[model samples]
Target chain A: MKFKTFAMFVGPSVFLMLLFIAFPLVSVLLNSFQVTQPVFTTQEVETCSAGFLTQNCVTEVKTIPVLDENGDTVTTTEWVGFSSYANVLGGQRFVDAITSFDLGALLRIDFWRALRFTLTFTLITLPLVLGLGLAIAVVVNNATKAIKGPVIFVSLLPFIITPVIGGLSIRWLFYGDGIVTVWLEALFNTDLSIAANGWAIEFLMMFYRVWHVAPFAFVIFYAGLQTVNQDTLESAVIDGASRWERLRYVVIPHLMPLIVFITLIHLMDAYRAFEEVIAFSSESYRITLQYLTYDYLTPDDAGNRAISSASASAMLTMVGVVILLAAPLRRTWQEHRGR
Target chain B: MSDASLPRAMRQPLSLKLASNAFLLVWLLLAAFPLVWILAMSFKSPVDAFSSSAWEVLTGPRTLSDGNGVSIVDIVLGIALAWLAIKAATKLLMPMTVAEGTLHRIFNWAVVALGFGTLFVIGFFFFLPLVAAPLEGLLGPLGQPILGITTEHYQAVWVENAFYENFRNSLIVTVGVVTVSLTVGTLAGYGLARSGSTLAFWILIIALVFRALPHSVLVAGYLPVFINSAEILSPILGENAPTLYGQPLAVIAVLVSINQPFTIWMLRSFFQNIPVDLDESARVDGCTHFQAFRWVIMPVMWPGVITTGLFSFLLAYNDFLVTSLLLDASNQTMVPAIAGYFNRETTTTDQVEAVAAAVSITAPLFLLVMIFQRQIVSGLTAGAVKG
Candidate 1:
């Protein structure tokens, strides 16, 4: 209980967190303003040739920089202030598209496209995760033990698999000539590929999100179910409340705080949509900011990486995520202070 | 739909009950069918597994079974089997006194009859095709037919894909993560529980915030250090020092850091439930605080620690992005390996091996879940229920 004892107890965890998490956060911020590239040089040399060509002369060994002194093509990292951010913003092209009011052109910017998907993914999945999870929890709570164990196990399957694998499983079901897709086409007497259109792909992504995460909500709500005041439930039963009314009045209110906790976790997670996009192979019709950062880091044909751009986008993404999480975060902080 | 005849206290409508059951059954299928199908596909021949229709997987070269009709005798026997199985299972599973009156017996009989009919249809249609095909394949020369199953896919995936190596890497990283997170997190959680200082409370709140920070965001932070390890780590250990990138140890460290916050939150509450008197008594008897924790506290807290450890294992095991990005290609984890299965060998890929690889990846986790379902669920819901 003493300060020294507490420090001795807690120091290792804090040290790990700071070294791995806090330090990297600061490093990312610093790296966003700096750039790195492969070093290149231009030079000439002199050589002697055979008698057929009399003599072949080359320039002396005078190394030349790949770019002018002030340009960005240098091999070394440079502190370029917000230039990386501006470049990521697509400065001239984005500004022109915006001024001209071309919606298609506006979305053509990789950052904007990724941001759009990320925002939609986060906002839309929030309510569904809460609602569906609550529904499953309520239903499962009333189930017999024999049924309950298997049902819980089944529900946790999606949540237990790795995110990328979960997405891939869902994608495989509707992939090219996949069983469900072909069966649907045969039954309905029409051909429609879920992966062929943007909206359809988005739909699958959204559906996958709900399936993958609702179990998390269900588990939390199921725990919350155990904490509901039994005396209050008994009193409500004596008052002849219907099941639905009991749920609305007694259960929902009891689980409100847990709901908020789940919402906070979901928002932060959903905003960083990387795995699903990759698993779904949605790069053609869709992308998320997280994937966009990875895209920047991917080596180009010439083997150069866009690390500064990736860092800038990562910063922008953090800004958006923070903004999205701010309200729930503040509420939690206030509750802690009150406690 | 009218329900007044059911009794005044139990006025629930038949329609509502039917609809609820139907909806829940549909949801159960949605949750379970994918895993079952994947399991089936994993055992199928490559020809059937990759066929445009999943039906072909079971319909291999064999003729179909005769049309089976349900008769009075078959129904009666089915109901008998269902009743016996349920009765025996209940006797083994619980100590409750089962109803045995004439009326209760009649009701149980009716329920078992319904269950029997359902099980019979499912077994005849789904399980029959699944099992017979495999049986026929292995014993076709003895007047049997095609089983449509093969071990070749699993063999190819295991031997050719370097799956064993990646699987080993995953095991090492996940185990390391669980050990590290539990050690530090339990101590920190106990410190918070015992200290009850405002500082400790605020630290928990901060940990929750970090828990909300997206992992991909954290991966972004780690990239520069990992990629520039020699430059960054040289001064700390002085030249030719070990670096973080391409090391399973680095992945394990990051995973532990990511998972520690949740571990502390879960264990702190569990530790709080232990009476402070126990620790005080140990201290009064001339034991140090550390000794009190190790001796007095730990024995009572094994369940909570195991629960936290299971969750930490899940976090490390289920992760892909952090492992894939930080570890070298040769040292990748299973989940990422499965995700990249096609791309890594697009030219040489037999396609059937994908499902085989997927099955292998899920096999360990499947066993883990089967063994610790209760602990995993409890760990997940810890601390969230209370206000």
Candidate 2:
């Protein structure tokens, strides 16, 4: 292709990406370092009110946002450097908690609390998803041909359903005298409240994530299983390798790149764990970093949003993604160079 | 060895086979039960929907007392009609339209779906009651309630709550995002696939990074711009330029950009698989680059395009965050609207209605999976296997 044609073909996509993805990144960085506030002015006026038998007048002062000619609030933006970041990171309260060696206090700060859950959720689910996915793939691989299609179809329901809806379905199953809870209560002869406990909510959230994501992993791994080297497997069998040995050595090694691929995709996705927070309504007990940023952006009753802090939190999330991506990215770069 | 032939070492032992099948059954249940359970709950009354007893949820005895039971005739006719529709769609409608290619097939599908929906409405509401009322009086026991099922929650949702409006908005957003993303993505992907330039590779790597960034990060960046877009555009379009905030178009643009990276990566891999020699020969035969691409390349790119389009459709349709934040109440999409039912105070009736809404949204997805399961499976493996 000529450079002109290539440019023509790639131009619109590049433009949109740069405008939406690239520009927003730079803007987020800049905004994180600045604060915007509506300018306020204090005013006093005499007020008259009709009493039961007499009129009473009083002068009172109130602060109000100054409106411009267009009836929009007049706002000013000022550079605040890292103050917003500090605020989002808990500022002096974080320092106090750290200096006091208070683990509970450290976890009490919203940012740290969110970070802990986000990291734990991502890390814990990785192994479970991988293991369950691999197990399903292997079992399905061994199944009769007639059953494979239906099995795959059934497995895909969880992955293909909307994330929020999937979460909601699982929540309905386990929350407040839900069928599963009821069954468990009957079996154990004890009462159980899933929603009332933080640990249970966290467990359910992770369980939902694993349920939702493992099918995706299964699909990918199943695809990977098809291309596994039969000659290598036969050679291992000839060498008297047991079934587990054959899998541990021949099969898993073949699927390692795919495992990495799934891991990278899973990490990227699980880091932005926002829907589970809403679907499970775990705001009181648990929140993820993405939800923390969203919480900041959502306006309160006073119609005030923490835009700067939201930006800071968003930037921090992007940084976390980049860090998680570093190893896989470097491996890709090396492979590209080697090729 | 042939694929059907299993070597002794490769085959599962008897005990292993039983255990594996058992495990697979357990997993299959785990995977499919929630959707089945939810769909069942949607048709029952609130009491039955939330009942601690699984048997009550399944039977919906309270729903029967509430004058919402389905007669044997209704059940038999409903199932027969549904079976006939599926058979017609597969055996007749599919063959008739599939030969005309993608666009025609899609149009045909829409027509068929619309026809089916109309038939269903007429059968359930207008025709079934009219027939069943007299039949129930005549047959007595035979025409009595065999199951407790109701469409009342669906009525409350799609009619009373006007959930159809959100469904319409969702359709618009998904359609716009898919069309725009695929158009731009296919061109760029083809360009990148054909180009051996280092810049293309680097661009792809950057796109990978962009794809990894959490959606909230992008939304944070877009929020300020969208909120002030009227001001930004006023200089170019006069003082009355409209704000991009709360507009479906704004959501479409954001979703397209968010989806573009994955789109490009997937499409580029697909494009790379098509032998370049076909286009090369077209160029040799006095075709311009654009003509070669259009006449020679795109003709064969349909499968890849359709696969990529399915994924793009899924992303845009399944999205909750961008749509919720960018759109206002009147313009809200189905996912966010369903979430709204729980966000506020709600009665048991409202919760069941919300369940109906959730089930309603999943119906199209179910249809999509049934029809496009092969395409979806291939699409999932396309990126991972190639990359």
**lDDT of residue A30 for candidate 1:** 86
Per-residue lDDT, model 2, residue A276, is 98
**lDDT agreement with native, every candidate:** 0.77, 0.89
The numbered model that scores best in lDDT is 2
Structural similarity to truth (TM-score) of each candidate: 0.84, 0.96
Candidate 1 whole-model C-alpha lDDT, 0 to 1:
0.77
All predictions: root-mean-square deviation over Cα? 9.1, 2.2
Q: Tens digit of lDDT per residue, candidate 2, span A109-176?
A: 99999999999999999999999999999999988999999888888888889989999999889987
Say what the interface RMSD of candidate 1 is.
2.5
Give DockQ for candidates 1 onward, in order.
0.45, 0.77
